[model samples]
Target chain A: MKINNLFVWLKQKPRIAFFMCLPLILMVACLIIYPFFYSIFLATLNKAETKFVGLANFLFLFKRETFWLVVQQSIFFALVAVFFKALIGFIAAHSINELPSKGQRKWRGMLLIPWVIPPALSTLGWWWLFEPTYSALNWLLEKLSVDAIPWLSETFWARFSIILVNIWVGAPFFLIMYLAALKSIPEDLYEAASIDGANYWQKLFFITLPMMKNIISITILFSIIVTFANFDIVRVLTRGGPIDTTHLFATYAFRVGIESGDIPLGAAVSLFMFPVLAVLSFIILRNVRKRTNEV
Target chain B: MADVEIKDLHKIFDRTEAVRGIDLSIKDKEFVILVGPSGCGKSTVLRMIAGLEEVTEGDIYIGDKLVNDIPPKDRDIAMVFQSYALYPHMTVFENMSFGLRLRKFSKEDIKKRVEEAAKVLGISELLKRRPRQLSGGQRQRVAMGRAIVRNPKVFLFDEPLSNLDAKMRGQMRIEIKRVHQHLKTTTIYVTHDQVEAMTLADRVVVMKDGKIEQIGTPDEIYNFPRTGFVAGFIGSPAMNFIPGNIVKNKNGYSVFINKQISFYLDKEKEKKLEGLDGKDVLLGIRPEHINEKKSEDAIEYDVKIDLVEPLGMETMVYFTINKVQLCGRVSPENNLMSNNKATLNFNKNKFHIIDPKTDKVI
Candidate 1:
């Protein structure tokens, strides 16, 4: 006679693995999946939460000029910041790598200081640096006879200031990643290229770049995600000032959902980034998988 | 003019001297090998010649032009590294043609040179394969092919076969020798393997402690080593060294061992040891010099075989003399056994008497 016992079945090896994973699964369910679903529900609800207004909140967000502005600003901010971060990171990694190994260690430690500090804390320091009257950078520029220009109050300069701060915080991560990639290249390959009549630039093109193709793609992908959702730098530096020109998805959502108390509309606005992000992530991840498999 | 000339070359890293004042001139088509133990600066010397390393204090001339200030790119030399150093991303063809393409060789000329080198290396069919797709031996051949396509003024190899298995190493050794013969280009090879030095080089340079111990043809290095180090380092199973003395005897003088056996020094050997009588010296006995009583006039010793290794062609016999393990070679037909007494014949004329204080052979 067979007893269909659930407890006995749960004692099996596969079931034990599942049981070991139960805490993380339960945490994800309660903390992440539940909120996600609740946000979706909130996006479809009427203002009083008594009636369903499916797609109306979304339609409302789609029609707003400020919402579209946030979309453009978010993409532009992420792309420009990631690009400069990658460029600075590669150049820094190369110059540091060229130093003797002892110097390389010291410089690497110094460059990584910004990354080691918490983003919010570092953003606060940057806010002080970008302060309109007491700005150290403007003081230096004025000392050099340059005219004083608005950093946070202007439309263009505010976006530029936020991107610059984002780059300062994020470039070190790229520096570490690219340095690791550069070190992974065999020293002998460079020597061989030297004997084969390749100068520095030739070696960089034929040997270094090809070897680092995968790391560059992967780092850019990772930085894009982090920068696209970035809030600390923008909030500290500009707070979407100068006519809300620099409002990104995260800061705009905070303004609407938490600050202005339009919870359902804010949820709908926040969810607007999801589909684009999903498609971009899917494309890039597939490309990364294909490239890594090649290696 | 000589193809390569190094004058009182020296290289020091930090405080440690890697290559101390050394002078060597290589003929236009000669194949010279620098053989030494690791950290002895043989590879450092080769790298200096290739301009990969800066000479701490000396001049290196290539083709009558002082090349000390030239970068490696203009050194007109191609090097094969121990790791093969092929571009992993490039196909075999692209890897071989890279230098040509960089140098602005015509398309047809690059193709011809690459195909010819590939044919010479027996890798014609592997042109499209990437380095990761090739086996260790094929990768080695491709590396050599990459060098061969250039037909540079000099070829430098830094332990190119060190990464290969023993079988592949032997095969590549023969292939390298054949290529050297075919190309007749000036070549310099560096290795820690004495067998490679003995078998490959037109002349071998033995180094120790960052200085050249001796430079000679293979036969001279094997038969007439100038120092005790060279004598001991050049042979397999190593040259057995026994401490002894030359004492005056009724019939001229004899090398006296530990009451086991002594033979009168020949006139030639006696002349070589003129002032060393009654002085302590190291007697260099190669394993091949000691056999199973080959001649009646040879000094005979009843040595208790401590260990017997029966190689297919020879039997290696080991015994302790003054706490120094001495190795001797006998025919495998002798069928020697361990823990048994066997009389070994020491070739009296072949004794290399060394003044232990100077470490120099008489």
Candidate 2:
């Protein structure tokens, strides 16, 4: 009787359940399942022809020397850029939070300016400053009696320029996240710490850092996924130039499929970014869920 | 525990003067309670003593050392906040030992002190639990336990029992009093609840508008409030104030209320009313001062009982005198019924008179 009554009540709320699930069901068919199987089908066969070339795309992916070099470059760029971004962002957030309430709003607004501007527009400015001729940075170095170094034409410098631009574009994200986490902490905890004879350094280590562990982990995870899969800043600033020293997975996919017209190889290279992003996403989501349970 | 002395302490917050220049000396092992209405700066005074607030002027001495420039941690004072402020992430043991750990005490020493405090507070079983896992009364006990573990020079409490329910508040009130009695720390507690102040404080400092209104023992405050505000504020259901004129009647001197109810005064009280016989004076009388079953033995007045508050042991009868509502406690066995007229007598010797202009006791 109880089960029948529950089913009757459920029938009464059919519209609510339907409205809630409409978008998700449609997205599963249109965006997720359809593209997933279709991408696998495209990756297995060679260009427009449905010839079963079993493992050729995977074997050819490893045989290409440029693919391995791009893999190393992407790892180097993402890890270095993420490290600097998270460190600088945490420091900037601490400074902003320490400001008086009235001044804090102005400083936060200024810090968000870089994050608010379009990444492509900002990268265009960086591209202009590192232009081979009439370069502003090289011109300034020459005036200071230093050699006019080729910023974009050199392998290491080109990679370094792209990583720097990524940091500039991404640090504000971490800054905002850390600031939110800092504000969520109650002021009473610090008061209690001070009353416990904890100096500033002791309080930061024992209270602030431990309390911010969840947020710090989630922010770094997000930075990893975004930096690894990033395309705009690298494509605009360096175009994976200087003998492919700065080529990341996203740009490599673009180069092989759009620039070089090797669709199957491009699909294989693009699919390589999935595992790194999936692992990072899983770790971040798990940490976030654990924190929610703790709270 | 040590004595605390504040001399001409003044604190100004922007345009408002929070704690005006005031001097007070609390003796060793004294439990002084600062009691006042909200925004009357009682908490500010307690915070100033805790070194949580900067003194804008004057000096504060904790056991003869001028601690005006000392930070809260170095002042050797522990505070139990109204919200308890227990570290939510730390267990009760950790919360109690945090200060000791920061001062770099030995691990065993911290454990011993925490255990001793938990035993004193009767919370030994709750040491491993975080604050969120504890009940409200338990959290209050943890907060007190944290303070007791420190054994500071003085203890500061900011309305620590306000968050508990009424019955729990009463129980915690007694527990706090017992803790104070055992520890004998020179504690400064702040609360807006006058009942708590009356029951818990060895001496109550009644404040208003950032200034001390009166400082005296609970009996002295209840029996001899120096001002009208103190008299009105210190008592539950408060003392009744009736506007009347002291007149020279045919028999002797008396206070006339309405055209009836002339309360005759004795010679000593009449002499005290010498020059003010015809002046406008307000009479203050406590609820318990009036008796319902009147006789010729005391001065009597006929009143129509408007309402009755039966409190099991006694009953409070509400009546009116000269358009002012007055309440008086009578024995529960009096068979008092609302809307019935009865003769009630005032204990003339205990009557208080205030100057209408200054509201000061005369």
Candidate 3:
């Protein structure tokens, strides 16, 4: 394992380091670097690829109302969904960590089922649950003498259904991360806090939260990236429909490039996510590094 | 008057009994130590006194009040854990002042108390540093400082020095004793090291297999151990146990080991082995009790040396008596080496005679 450390090898042998880096360099050039530049090149061409229409696709997308809606909803959808996922995941991890080991295992397994199932398959089941006539939730509300609510047919409910499904598929990842972090904390800390006259809430705020801060930041950062470009839930459940209220960047790109047959426009729309992702990663990673250094 | 008393204490984890029927009454200002091997329930007893673990049966009293249901926070006790358990994110000042801050002490009061404890611990300059920045010894001092800052009625230390190196452990042992003398708070320290027990405790409670084997002053424990287990457990290099028989000789009754090794019973020793003539008994000989130089009122035996260990000031010479290995501490000036034929002198009065059947010192 020590032999696999790159920094050690780089410092010890220059020739071997260059030789080792060749495969990765070739991979980036052929698979990643080439594709990224080619996508940018494709974004510059017109729909039929017959004419160079520099800035036209960008100008057009900037002018469209649906493009603006997708932009607003993607940011909203990523932030709100990631926030709820993190909150629910933290609560579940904290609660399950308090249980006996056997019970904790049972609950952890059951909660992870949502994450383990394929997203498209699960989203299909969710779409059926949101059917206008046969939605099981609305049937329960109707039996309770409450008005049946529109799930997929209305814009608000459609966006709500998509965010709910996204959270369901992403929260288990956070639960596993936070739970491992919780277990890694020494039990002596809690015992010391007890002897130091700390109540439960005091221990939580003073000890647990501070110790888990780095893991919390890292998990949220990863969830933000994954949730921002989420596709399966919006595609399968709402089909980016209900007047495009639930159109995340991924689904919007799919509609413009693959479905609507405007490859250049779709490339530009998908390219829009890179800047936002890069900025969010920069901020969260900086905080994480600062916290780690302080520690 | 914050003495600690435990009556009929027991701690059972599932089917394994950790502490069984332990009764200890530590006087106010007394520094009592619980010493034992691993799995001896010494730490369990300490935790029950600190209220970190639930009392499976019976009662614990502090300051004359039964505290069976009291939480550790309300028990008015402070513990220095073995791992130190200093909060990594907080400065040493905050770590030491956490208890007082929890009780709503003013900032100035908290700062004064923390500074005082830090000065006592010689860690005043490390106040701004976090735990990760401190060395093992400094972290240990910070843990002690945290306990001292609380100024609780009782102080509990659970193997606090076991994590340090040998040199650091020795230094911290004296530091702990000095701290105990200064604070004069009723303190209960737990350690598996017999050296720590002997050096630190006003009285040591030796435990084994979830039960107390003996409780006495260090001198009493070392010299007049009532049980064979106590005799074997207290000393370094351990007490060598050799089984021999008492036989009536032409002069009087003597302990004989293959005719080459025998100790003539004096008047006092005769009285000790009265009515047990010709019966089997175990000789408990400490290494220091067996010396190479001759002395008054000691027995001499010639042995073929098996091993020699030079320890600067003294040499531990290993030999055998009738195929049973025995060790003797001698001055290293002789340069005794293995396979040498030497005469070892055994202090007749110093050796203990334990009855083979009862395993009790006679």
Model 1: per-residue Cα lDDT at residue B182: 96
Error of 3 at A150 (Å): 0.6
- lDDT tens digits, residue span B1-362, model 1: 13899899999999999999988989999999999989999999999998889989999999989999999989889999999999999999999999989999999999999999999999999999999999999999999999999989999999999999999999999999999999998999999999999999999999998899999998999999999999989999999899899998678988887787677777766677778879998999899888886786677878889999998888999988788898999999888899999988888888888888988998
Give candidate 1's error at residue B182 in angstroms.
Answer: 1.1
Between the candidate structures 2 and 3, which one is better when assessed by lDDT? 3
State how far residue A278 of model 3 sits from its true place (Å): 1.4
True contacts kept of 1: 0.89
**Model 2: CA > 4 A from native:** A1-15, A24-29, A47-49, A139-149, B248-254, B264-277, B293-297
**Model 1 per-residue lDDT at A107:** 98
lDDT of 1 by residue, A174-272 (tens): 999999999999999999999999999999999999999888988898788888988888787788887889999999998888888888988988887
TM-score of each: 0.95, 0.93, 0.93
Pairs of residues at least 3 apart in sequence or in different chains that clash in candidate 1: none
lDDT of each: 0.91, 0.88, 0.91
Per-residue lDDT of B208 in model 2: 90
Better of 1 and 3 by DockQ: 1
